[model samples]
Target chain A: MRIAVDAMGGDYAPAQIVLGAVEAVRKYKCDIVLVGDEEKIKAELAKTGMANNPHLIIHHASEAIEMGEHPVEAIRHKKDASLVVATKLVKSGDCDGVLSAGSTGAATVAAKMFLKMIKGIDRPSIATPLPTTHGIALLLDSGAIVDSKPRDLTEMAMMGSIFSKYVYGIDNPKVGLLNIGEEETKGNKKVQATYPMLKQAKDVNFIGNIEGRDIPSGKADVVICDGFVGNIVLKFAEGLAVTLFQLIKDAIKNGGILAKLGAVLVMPALKKLGRRLDVSEYGGAPLLGVNGCCIICHGSSNAKAICSAIGVAIECVKNDVTGHIRDSIAEEELLANDSETI
Target chain B: MRIAVDAMGGDYAPAQIVLGAVEAVRKYKCDIVLVGDEEKIKAELAKTGMANNPHLIIHHASEAIEMGEHPVEAIRHKKDASLVVATKLVKSGDCDGVLSAGSTGAATVAAKMFLKMIKGIDRPSIATPLPTTHGIALLLDSGAIVDSKPRDLTEMAMMGSIFSKYVYGIDNPKVGLLNIGEEETKGNKKVQATYPMLKQAKDVNFIGNIEGRDIPSGKADVVICDGFVGNIVLKFAEGLAVTLFQLIKDAIKNGGILAKLGAVLVMPALKKLGRRLDVSEYGGAPLLGVNGCCIICHGSSNAKAICSAIGVAIECVKNDVTGHIRDSIAEEELLANDSETI
Candidate 1:
């Protein structure tokens, strides 16, 4: 299968993207199409020493979307932008999926505008992986569709459950509504309204409501919330992890001679722990519910992160997550009335 | 100042609460009134060896609210509950403030029902302390006032700012609206509606929007959001910190002999870092915008946490935070129109 990579997106564009594409070709045996400015992409690819490899292709686009550009405006105006062109390839079925370590907003916009949504899906969502004690739990609508209606949340539960089962290989994933309290009645208007709808869906294992503390405890395989709340939780966890690690480092370095020795002895273990909390280690979060799979990496992602993202893109295609979501939504639509869609 | 503390409240109950109350009396010279079943409070106080101190008093409370009880229902039915009695003490002007490690919902309901709202205050908000690199940042509406209106958010900003300036002694504390993006136009209906209201408030040092990542960075002194979002962020941070610390401990313990030795050596430094992130270290979050000071501690709080919460109670009374809020909100009401108040 072929995957189109946005070569000019992310903080470490071109170089890391090109290197990751080459590594993906060797590891996953999937053809990679580098879509970006040819001169720069070619220069970066040359450093990989596999620029002439038949598995690696360069379908250069003239324009590139900047990290700060307005998502919809960028997609509308930058017709030839790398992100738009890459998404267009997936839309045309020229590529099975697309990957980017770019502006998530831009990627989501382009994906919706070009690739569109799967049948019976009203909105697309970002299905992000959060590392838990038992393993990884999926948090969906992770900054894709904010101000969600009950129907929107039920859709998230469906898509998140499908992604967990297909991509993560979790059978009968337990879906929980993210709320302030674990009680079924506790939550804001959006969540409370969504609770009954989620429980109504027989396809998902609705485990009732789960609080923020429950996320790390692996109480549920999939926790769903509005994109606004989901994004806040995801980013806050990211920032808190960074601060705590920094605090630990400073403490270890400042502690007298004994602490310094301890730091040395425990370095390996600490590294392992860090890897467990690191976002890049888990690969990119997939923008689920779109017509084709689109994986979004953090903008500051390195080559390793990009490689993991490529792996994620391959898994999504191989697992047919989008297809499963389409089928599930279609079944839900057939069983429920038209008013239930809202 | 005299602070009434619910002696039978947290996980540790009367024993820790009595010990903490004794410590508070010694440190701040504030009179402590322990509200609970008379026999239980007396027994616990005797253990602290300060049972005979004239500054320590036991107010008999026949009932106690369980953590799992529905908040409003518990407040209504458990008239003789320890939490209700403590707040009633504040209401009757017999105590300067009230502190509890009881159900947050119970504390909030009691405070609102007994003490009432400060003049022109739309809703009472819980201003929680979050540990950050620069120190601690205050997150408001942190479980109180869920599903906030635009006016409710503006009130949180006002109250949080007053809290930072008076209690934390920060001058012109930077207040921010927590949203998905840094852009003014980049949030859901609630946040987007609240943005301009905060900006219009001439008294506030409105710094525009802050994303979740900015929270741990200490970029804003006061971050305001609806309790639904605020509570999630707070809980997520707490859970993540616990997980990371656990990971570190396990990493060190499971690592070979050298790592185990290193763990012992680094124990002191790790403890210091842990204290920095510990909820009890910063004391309880004040239930702001109330007619009287009300500090709410965690259910799992120990003696040290209780003592810190007592300290917070004394500070709120000394700072006259509620009085200041009354004045501020009165002024805000004069400026903003009606229908803004919920």
Candidate 2:
């Protein structure tokens, strides 16, 4: 299988992207088409000492979207942008999936505009795997489409459950509506309205409502919320982790000689803990509900992060997550028809 | 100032509550009336050795609201509940303020029902002071009211700003609308509509939009959002902190002998860090936009937490936050009338 990588996206851009692609080609044994400016991609490829690697390919794109550009405007105007070209490859079936560590808005826009939505899915969502005490839990609509309807939330629950089962291998994933309280009657009007719909959903293990505190507890395999709420939770967790880590560092630094000695001795253990909490280590979040696989990484991702993202892309394609979603949607329609006739 | 404490509220209930009230009376030289079952309050207070302290008084209440009961139903039915009676003490001008470490929903319901809303305030809000790297940042509407209107958001900003300046001593505090993006056009339809209204609000700094990431950074002194979003962010942060600290402890435990030794040496510094990140250390969040001071503590609060909450209640009463809010509302009306003439 071949995967297209947006070589010009993210803070590290062509260099890290190229290195990650070379690593992916060697490790995963999958063909990777590096899509970006030919000359810059070639320069970065040379540094990897795999410029002549047969498994690696380069698909040149003339334009690149900046991180600050308007997503829709950028995708519409930059016809040959690296992200656009990469997604186009997946749409054309030349590549099974696409990966990008760029402006999430831009990547989502490009994926929707090029790959389009899977049938029966009204909107696409970003399903991110958050690290928990026991395992990983998936939070969907993590800043894709906001102001989601009740039906839209039900769709997210279904798609997120599928992604968790097929991609993460969670069996009979418990899907919970992200709400203020555990009761079905809790949360805003939107989530309150969505609760009954999720409860009635077939093939999905609805676990009623789960609060924000439940996210990291791994109470549910999949947590569903509107993109607006999901995005805030994700980003706030990110920020709080950063601040807490910083506080620990400062405490150690100012704790006199004993603290410094302790820090040196516990460095390895702290590093291990950091890895467990690192967002990049889990690979990129998938922009689920699109026709083809599209993995969106953080814009500040390093080569390691990009490489991990490629692994996720491969997993999605191999497991045929998109196919399962399509089948599930079809089954859901059939169930709805039966209920209506009754 | 005399403060009323809900001695029958919280997991620790009368034991911690009575102890905290005694400590507060001694430390702050303020009066405290513990509202709960007479026998229970007397038994707990006797353990503190200052049972018959001149500044401490016990007011008997026949009922107590359990954490799991429906908030509105419990508050409406349990008229003689500890929390209800405590709030009544403030309403009757017998107590300067009321503090509770009970069900947040019940506390909010009791406060609203008894204390009522300040003039010109659409809805009351819980303004919580979150620990930041530099200092503290206040988050408002932290699960008080959901599906807030644009005008409600503006009111939150004004009340939050007043609370920050008077109680927290942050002069000219920067108030921000909590949204998904930094841009004015970002976030769901609710926040987007609230943006222009916040900008037009008077007596507020109105620093435009702040993303979830900005919260921990203390970029904005006051972060305003609907109660739903604010509550989620607050709870998520609490959960993440617990998970991370537990992870660190587990890492050290699993590591070899050297790691265990390092933990011993760094225990003090880690303890200090823990204290800094501890939400209980910062006292309780005040229920802003209420007619009287109402500080809400966590349901699991211990003696120290309850004492800190009492301190917060004292500060609110001493600074006359409720009176300031009343003045601010009056000034806002005069400004609105002037703007109409212009």
Candidate 3:
């Protein structure tokens, strides 16, 4: 299967993106189509001695979307931009899936405007794999839809469960709503209303509300919430991890000779721990409920992150996650006997 | 200032609570009144060898509120419970403040019922100190009001600013409305509506919208949001810190001989770092907008956390935070030309 890569998207664009595409093409037996400014992409590829890869192809574009630009407006104006063109390639069936490490809003706008949402899906949700003690929990709607109704949250649960089962190979993935407390009536009005809807969903193994403290312990396979709360939780987790690690590093450095020596001795193990907690190591967040498989990577992603993002794209394509979600939604509708339920 | 302690509250009950109260009285130079089963509290106090301190006093109470009991129900039924009695002391002007490390819900209910709200305040808020790159940031409504309006969030910002200045010694603390993005119209309806009110408020230094990722970096001195979002962010940060520290500890334990040696050498530094990130070190969250100072410590608080909670109470009393909030609200009303506004 072929995957389109936005080579001019992330902070380490062109260089890392090209290297990642070349590595994926060489290591994983998949065709890679790199999209970016032709001259820059070629120059970066030549510098890495990866210009001769037969499985790699260049899809050039003249414009790039800035991180600060309005997502919808930028996509509409920069039609030939790397992200927009890559999304169009997926929409036209030229590629199996698309991957980008750019502005999340821009990626969402492009994916929805070009590829569109799947049938029976009201909005596309972003689902990321959160590493927990029990294993990995799938957290959805990290920032896609800011305001959502109870029904929207239920849809996210169904979509997240299917995605985890198909892509992560977890059978009967348990779905949960993230809130202040585990009780049914413990959260805001939106969560209180959504609790019953999720409980009644047929396809998902609804396990009820999961608190934020339970997230790291992997209390549920799929932790669903509205985009506003989900995004804050996701970002808070990321920031806290980074802050703690930095504090550890600072403590070692500031503690004089003994601490510096200790830091050096355990540097390898600490490095491994850092790698495990790194966001880039987990690949990209999947934009679920869409017509095509799309992964949104971090804006500052490096070569490793882009490579893992490509791997995620390949996994989604191979597992047929989109089809599984469609089937799940259809099956749930049939069970509930309501076509407008979602 | 005399602070009433719920001597039978928290996981360790009279033992840790008594020790913490003794420490607070000695270290912070504050008079302590222990409220609980008088016999048990005196027995626990004997173990700490401070039973003879002239500053320590004991109030008789025959019952205690179990953590598992419903908060409102417990307060209604257990009239002479430790927490209830302690709250009553504050209500009757027998104590300057009350400290409890028991049921958060119970503490909230008792504080609201006994201490009452400051005039012109619709609802009270719980403000907790969150660790950030630039020291501590104040986050309000950290599980107090689940459902809130735009005006509530605006009031929280004003209260939070005044709190940071008085309690944390921050001058003109930059206040930010937590949202999905940094744009003018980035978040859900609540945030969108709250933005204008925050901007219009003359009592606070409004910094516009801040994303979740910026929290750990101490992007703002005060991060204002509804209780739902605030609660999630607080728990997420706590969980992530614990998870990361556990992972680090595990890595050091299983990383062979060199890693073990490194851990031993850096044990002191690591322990200090861990302590710095510990939530218990920050003491209890103060319920803002109450007529008197009320601190709500975590349920699992140990002796150290209990002591910190009492210190928070003393700080509030010294700063006259409640009186300041009352005056600020009055000034804001006069400036807005709306005497009926809350």
lDDT tens readout by residue for model 3, A1-342: 999999889888989888888878876889999998999999998988878777889999899998999998999898899999999999999999999998999999999999888888899999988888667888888989878888888889888887888878899998889999887878989999998888778787998888888788788899998899888888877776677668878888888888888888888998887677676777899999888999999887888888888998999999998998888777766766765565
Tell me the docking grade of candidate 1. Answer: medium
lDDT per residue, candidate 3, B1-342, as tens digits?
999999888888888889888888878988999999989988998888988888999999999999788899999999999999999999999999998888888998999999998888888889988878668888887989888988888878888988899988999999988888889878899899999888989789999999887888899999998898888888877676678678888988878899989878888897887777677788889999889999998877888888998988999989999999999998877877774564
Tens-digit lDDT track of model 2 for A1-342? 999999999999988888888888888999999999999999999888899998889999999999889999999999999999999999998999999988999999888888889888899999998999988999998999899999899999999998899988989999988888888778889998999888889878998998888888889999998899999898888887777678888899899899989988888998998888787888899998889999999888888888889999999999999999999999888888998999
lDDT of each residue in A95-191, candidate 1, tens digit only: 9999998899999989888888887888888989999988999998799899888888888888889889887899999998989998877878778
Q: Chain B TM-score per candidate, please.
A: 0.96, 0.97, 0.96
Clashing pairs in 2: none
Q: What is the fnat score of candidate 2?
A: 0.71
RMSD of each: 2.4, 1.2, 2.1
Q: Where does the lowest 10-residue lDDT sum fall in candidate 3 chain A?
A: A333-342
Candidate 2 lDDT tens digits, B253-328 = 8888999888888889989887876888889999988899999998888888888999999888889889998998
**Ten contiguous residues minimizing lDDT sum, candidate 2 chain B:** B236-245
In model 1 chain A, the worst 10-residue window by lDDT is A333-342
lDDT, model 3, position B336: 70
- Least accurate 10 contiguous residues by lDDT in model 1 chain B: B333-342
Considering lDDT, where higher is better, how would the candidates rank from best to worst? Answer: 2, 1, 3
True contacts kept of 1: 0.74
- Model 1's alpha-carbon lDDT is 0.88
